[model samples]
Every structure is written in structure tokens, then in C-alpha cells.
Target: MNTLFGSNLKYDLKASLVVFLVALPLCLGIAIASGAPPMSGLIAGIVGGIVVGALSGSNVSVSGPAAGLTVIVLDSINSMGTFPLFLATLVIAGLIQLALGIAKAGVIGYYFPHAVIKGMLTAIGLILILKQIPHALGYDVDLMGDQAFLQTDNHNTFSEIWYAIQYYSIGAIPIVLVAMGILILFERPKIKNHKILGVVPGALWAVLSGIIINLAYGVWKPEWQLGGDHLVNIPVLDNLGQIGNLLTFPDFSMIGESTFWIVAATIAIIGSLETLLSIDAADKLDPHKRTTPPSKELVAQGIGNSISGLIGGLPVTAVIVRSSANVASGAKTKMSAVLHGVLLMILVLSIPTILNLIPLSCLAAVLFLVGYKLAKPSIFISIYKNGWDQFIPFIVTVVAILFTDLLVGIGIGMVFGLFFVIKTNFVRSVTLTEMNGNYLLKLQKDVSFLNKALLMKNLSRIPSGSKVIINAQKAQFIDHDIQEVLNDFIASCSDKNISITVEGFKYKIHENI
Candidate 1:
């Protein structure tokens, strides 16, 4: 146990700081997007990092308030008539997630095709790049962390980019350029291999640079300085003693309302699905290639969500953005996640004023790098080389996700993936050959109704006076629809002057028919 925690303390600590930086703005952005108190996002982040990180079987996944849930949270909050009632739903949602974990529903994640999973990762990477461009340019019209193509600000992803171009902040450009440059510099072998310099991540330096540069701007270039929505906006508490004022408890009175149950079920199901997908993606990104136990992750998320709700926070889920950031920053274990949570609790409680100094554009630069790694050109080329069977679904998933939301995009990709699977099975299940008026029809494996069309087409092409042999030796199970087709074919064989023989079938063929 000691070895597990101690072996990679240095790496985990550094990675944790990077993840803390990445998560800070996101937690606040998602809360704002959801129309919830900004403190609720931080609470969710802490619970997700500490509670879920400790309980999860995952080595690298990070959890927090997800942007994907913002719409649902916003609509629910308004419809429910109060935030505390919504908090009650979150508690029930957590309980339902626990039930789902106990029922072993995490296995559903494994059913997603590798292509679809890859597509999701690439899609998210693209989303990070496209979405962050505006923030990096200081066009703060849309909330940070909003991933959907259509923004609440009445602009689509592409349209928003155009708008950002027109209204870009001059001050933010220098910060983004410098931060991106520093991030790239840190990737070099000399700096990365250095004993002292390598100890700190590029993202940390970028953030510090952003703070110092902005402070300098305040003194020299007052006209170009960034403030207000351009910087991190976490709520600052007056003191540790007033922490209770920020924490809101769930109202149990709403528990008896049917609407409360509906909202709970929605949160539970969506949260679990997102968690499963994020964990699967994180496992894929792991350098050691370790697999996380999905059911255990669900339980962890459930506990995190329940704790978050009790403390007046948003629902928690395994978030790919933070998890990917954790991986990219060289996290070695779940300790990074836990340490990040600890840092969030300490820093938010102790020095929110200091944190508020960091510019959002610098953080956007950090994500810009992380996004590039996930959706690199080589990844697309590699998947394409695997042939259309894989590439079609992968590309479809990428486009679907780019145009719509994550879950909806995945669902569409799943349908295409499943179609290719069925098509492959249909082709391989049956074979037909004809030579010199002698015909052979072979059922190679389990023949289902899907193969019936091909079987009928083969039968229809046989010429009159042909001698036919039906071979089923390799088939384990033939569908009733296929059996009926065979029966009808046999009944009509006399008119065509076809001679039929059956082999390895379980039932006797009607020779006289």
C-alpha cells in the first residue's frame, strides 16, 4: 500500500498541480453554464477529485462538474422552482448510480466499438481546440467549458470563431502566444530532462507568466489589460469561518414530488454513462495500458455525486477533459487526482484572490496543446489505414460529435458501427458455388435471418436440371426464417427439375417434396 502511494510521489505531485490548473476554470465555467452558484462547481470538483479519485479503480481518470450536463441542470433548476430541490434530485441520482454500480451495469461501456471510442477522443480534442480558440482570443461571450456545437449565446461553433476574430482582445493575444510558446518549449528534451526545471509543468509556468504579464500590463498598458470575464472568476470567501455560508444543504421536502424522481433518474443515468465513457477513454490513454474496473468507477462517482449534493454542488462525472489533461501532464497514478482535489480545497479556501489573478487565455493555451495531442493527424491516418470497416464509424463518430452533443453523437456512431458488424456477419455466414450445373450451398456458421436474403438469391440463380447439395456441417444454429426458406425451396425443386441433397442438418429433408 505504501509502495502504491510512494513510488510516484514526485510525478503525481507535479501532475496534480497541472490538473488543478486545468480544472479550476472548468469547474467555474460549467457552474456558470448550468446557472448554479460558482461555489457549487468547486465543491463538485473537490468531491470528484478526493472522493471519487480515492474510491475509483481508475489510475488516471479525473471527475468534476461536466459541461455535458449543463443544459439538463439548467432546465431542471428552472422547472423545479428552486436550487435546493434540484440538490435533492442530485442526492437521489447518486443513490441510483450506486444501485446501478451494484447491478454491474458498467459492462455496457465495453460494448462500444474501438472505432467509436477513438472517435470520441478525437471529437473531444477537436472540441477543445475549436471551443478554446474564442476564450484564448478573449471573446468571453460563451461560458468557458461549453463543448456543444450550438452555444447559449446564439452562435454555433464556427460562427463563434468568426465573431471572436472580429472582437478579439489585443492583450489576450500576447498571453496566448507566450503561454503556447512556453508550453512548446517545455516539451523539449533539454528542459523536460532537466532535474529542477522538469519538476514543474509547462502549464504552471504559462499560468504564472499570464499572471505576471497581466500585472505588468496593469502598470504599463492599462488600455490593453484583461479583467472581468477575461480572468478566472471563482467566488472569494471572506474567511474560512464563513465557509458554511457558501455550502447549501439539499431540501428533502422535494423528495415526495414525482418530478424530483424524474430529475434524479436523468442525472443518474447520464452521469453514469459519461463516467463510463470517460474512464474507458482514460484507460486507452494510459501509458501502462492498465484497465480500470468500470463497476468500481460507477460506485466512486455515485459516492462523489452524493457527497457533492449534500454540500450544495453539481452532479459529478468522470470528465474526459480533466482526465486527458492529467494524462498529458504525466500523471502516474490515482494519487494525482486526489492531490489535485486536496490542492483545490486548500487553495480555494485559503487564497481564492490569488487564483483569480490567473488569466483564462493561458489556460486555454494549455488545453490547446492537450487537444492537439488527442486529435493529431497521425491518429486519423492510423485509423484510416485500418480500412473502411473501421474508418467509416470512426469518421462518422467524429463528425456526429462535432455537429451535435457527445451522447447523441455516440448513439449515432453506435448505429453505424453495429451496421458494419451485421454486414460483415451476413457476408461470412453463407456461401454458394456452382460448377457444371451442380450447385453447393454452405452455411459456414450460425445462420440468422440476416443471411436469408443472400441464401434466397443464391437459390434463385441455380439453373434448371441442376443437382444441388445443401451443407450445414459448420453451422451451429440456423434461424427459423432460414429453415422455412429451405423448406419452400425444396417444395419447388420438382418444377425446376433440380435434385437436392441435404447434409449435416439436424432434421430430415423431405426428399419426395
Candidate 2:
């Protein structure tokens, strides 16, 4: 246990706490945004943290209700009108994921082009910048903040921006500009090198700016609520007893509707893609050069979703935001995730009041950092250096994801990459080995015109005096290039008295004495 647990579980606990701090607000925000009962997010987190953590093979992935699933969840809820029916679909989605895992379909992740991933991160980052502006400027019109482009204040993203602009709070705008300036200036290495700020994360500084602005708003415009659309408004509880009231069961009678299945399918596919993509990224970040068991993750997610459905929660996956937080916090094991869940439960139950102190703007700042990590310039440079083959799909994937939805873009990019690889491998001849360490160039399949280059390259590698066997016992056809090479090589072999065996293919011997 110690070998796996490490010497200081302290780091894990600390990391877990950091992640929990981040997860708590997101859970509620996502739940509300998905149009589900606010309690659903917390339930998913509890299940993801407690149940999935124990069962997962992933060392660092933190499971939760992801923003990606909001569209599916909300759609399901709308169509079904009953949460229980939605729950049934969640169960089905889980089963499908489990089967994918068991079938070792984890390779599906590798097919995504790197460009698409880069594009995705960049797009999400751009969306983050747009969404956070309202919160940074203290607009509180609707909680439709960050990446989910559907606006609650208005239907379109542009309208949401317009709404924020029209009601732009002077108190909030100045604060945002000041904080943004500080963020940009501090990010410069020359300024950061002074150690005056002493290794403060951009998010911490941003959050600090938010608190200061929040307090200033209290004094300058106390009568007017400056933050119109960006505040996180989870209902605060005074005591531990309030947690019991946190859960909200979905109405199950809507199960008969076809929309429930459509929603369920949406959740499963998108969730799986998101999870797989995250798994690939997390593996790349691992110091141990480990490949996470994607299939196991699918099973774990299946179980998580099943449980979430039964207990009235949203779908679960290995969310990149929380996983990145786990990495940033120096987590070394899944224990960090498990403990984070426990901490979430405790805090929600015992100190719900403490959570109210954190402002929504502060959380948006953290998300800003996350979006940046996913879309950094270095990621772009690295993918380009990997050569055109890797670069193309990656680019396509990103472009598709940005313009279209997540899964569609990745699918298009992967198709291109697959064709490129297969077309490169079809022009080859076969080689059979003899027991005596020599090699036989054997022709089995049809010696199509494509085999000429391979035949030439191979014929050039043969030593001056080495014995060779040419066997074509099963071949029905031999192209001219192959036959010519074999016929030409016999002269040198006879001159050197080199042993040669030609089986199944008739050849005339030439005497040159």
C-alpha cells in the first residue's frame, strides 16, 4: 500500500483540496446552466469523486459533470419532461461506454488529429475570453458563462454580448480593465522575474482582483447590482442539515419519449470523445510515460453515469478542467480525487457558508487559465514539428470542432489521417525467412505493378555471394519487374557459384562458360 500511496499523502490531500475548491462552484454552475436541478452537479461530483475514484485505473483524472454534457442534459430534460426518464438514458449511455471499454476501443482516441485538438483548445479559450467578460465586468443577467454558447439572457452568443454591453456596469468595467492589465503585465517574464508577487498564479491574482472589485462595488454602487450576468448564485446553506435537501430527483415518466434516447446518445458519444481526448492529453503530461487505460475509463464512466442516473445527477466523465487542476496541484494518485470528493461533501454539509465568500468572477479567472493551457502556442508548434501527417488531422480536428460541434470535427480529421496512412503501405513485396538465417523473397499475393520499387530496393540489398531462395508456390501472378530482377540476378550468382533455389516458378538456366 505504501509503495502505491507514496511517503507523503499530504501532497495528495493538498492537491485534492485545491481541486475541490475549484470543483465546488463549477458543479453548481454547470447544473444550473444545464437546466437541471442545481443539486445534480454536486451528486455527480460526489459519485465521480467517491465511486469512480475508487474504481478508476487513472492516477490523476478527476471525474465530474463536464460543460460538454450540458447541451445533452438540457435537451434530454426538455424532451422528456421527466428527469427519471432521462436517468434511464444515462444508464443506457453508461452501459455502452462500459462495453466500449471492455472491447478495448481505447484506440479511438489516437485517431484524433493533433491540429483538431489544438483548434479545440484555442476555440474554447476564445470562448472563455468572451464568456468571462460579463463576470469580469460584473454583469449578472444570466449564468450562461464560459463555452456553452447558448445564452439564457438571450438565445444567441452575440445577443448575450450585446446584453452585457448595453447594461455594462461602470463599477465592473474599470475593475475588469485594471485586473486584465495586471494579468497581462504580470505574465511578462521580465516583470515576473522580480519575484515581487512571489510565484502567484494568474488565477489567484485575478481572483484577488475580483474580491477587491467586489468590495469596491459594495462601497461605490451599493444600491445597484453591477454584476448583471456573471455571478454564481448557488443557494447557501447555514448548517450540515442542508445537504440532505441538495439532491433533486428527475421525473422518470418521460422515459418513453424518443428524445430521451437522443439525449442519452448525445451524452454518451460526446462524453466519450471528451474523456478519450482528455485521457490522451493526461498521458502526454504523465512523468511516468504511462498510457491510461481508456477502456477502463469507459467502464468507470459507465458506472458513474449509471449511479448518477439512479441518484438524480448529470452524466460524468474525466473532465479536463478538473484533471488539469489535479496536475497543477501536484497530485500523484487517484487518492487526490477520492479525497477531493470527500472534502466536497464535508464542505457542502458543514461549511456551506464559507463557499458563499468566493465570487463567480474568481472562478471565471481560473477557467481562463485552464482554457489557455489547452490552447497554448507551444502545443501548436509541437504539432507542426511532428510533420505534415500528424499536422493535417490535428488542424482539421480543431477547425471542425470550432465551426461545428466537438465529435463531428474530430471524425472528419480522423478520416483524413486514416486514408493518408493506409495509402502509404500498399506497395510492398513479402519476405520469408529460412531456418539457416538466410532470407527468401517470396511472392504470395498478386505481383501488381506497385511492387516494382520494393523489388528494386530489396534486390540491391543482396550480398555479392550470398545464397538466396525465391519461392512463389502460392502466387498466381508475377509482374515483369520482379521477374526481370530474378532473371538478371542469376548471371552473377552462377559466376560466383552462389547457391540458389527457385521453387514453384519455372526458370531456364543459362550457361556462360
* lDDT score at residue 348, model 1, on the 0-100 scale: 93
lDDT (10s digit) by residue, model 1, range 1-513: 788767788888988998999899999989988999999999999999999999999999999999889999999999788899899899889989998998999999899889999999999999999999998998988888789999987679999999999999989999999999999999998998799999888889999999999999999999889999999987887778898998999988978888999999999998999899889999999999999999888888988899999999999999999999899988999999999999999999998999999989999999999899999999999999999999999999999999998998989999999999888889888888888878899998899998888999988898889999999999999999999999999999889898998999987556563
- Over 1-513, each residue of candidate 2 has an lDDT whose tens digit, in order, gives 886666537657766876776787778878888888877888899898988888888888889888777776787777766667777788778877887878888778876654555555555555565666666555655563234555554355556667767776656665556555665675576755455562444445665676676776678777533442345445667665656676655554655767766777777878888889877766655556577788888888888888888778889988766887677656788899899889877776665554554566566556566566667788779888988877777777666655555556556766877765644443434554545546587777666566666776776666656678877776678777667666777767777656777777754433431
Quote the positional error of residue 433 for candidate 1 in Å: 4.9
TM-score of 1: 0.95
Where model 2 places Cα greater than 4 Å from the true spot, the runs are: 1-10, 103-107, 110-126, 139-167, 173-209, 220-228, 250-266, 423-513
Give candidate 1's total backbone clashes: 0
| Candidate 2, run of 10 with poorest lDDT | 224-233
Model 1: runs farther than 4 Å from truth? 433-440, 461-469, 490-503, 509-513
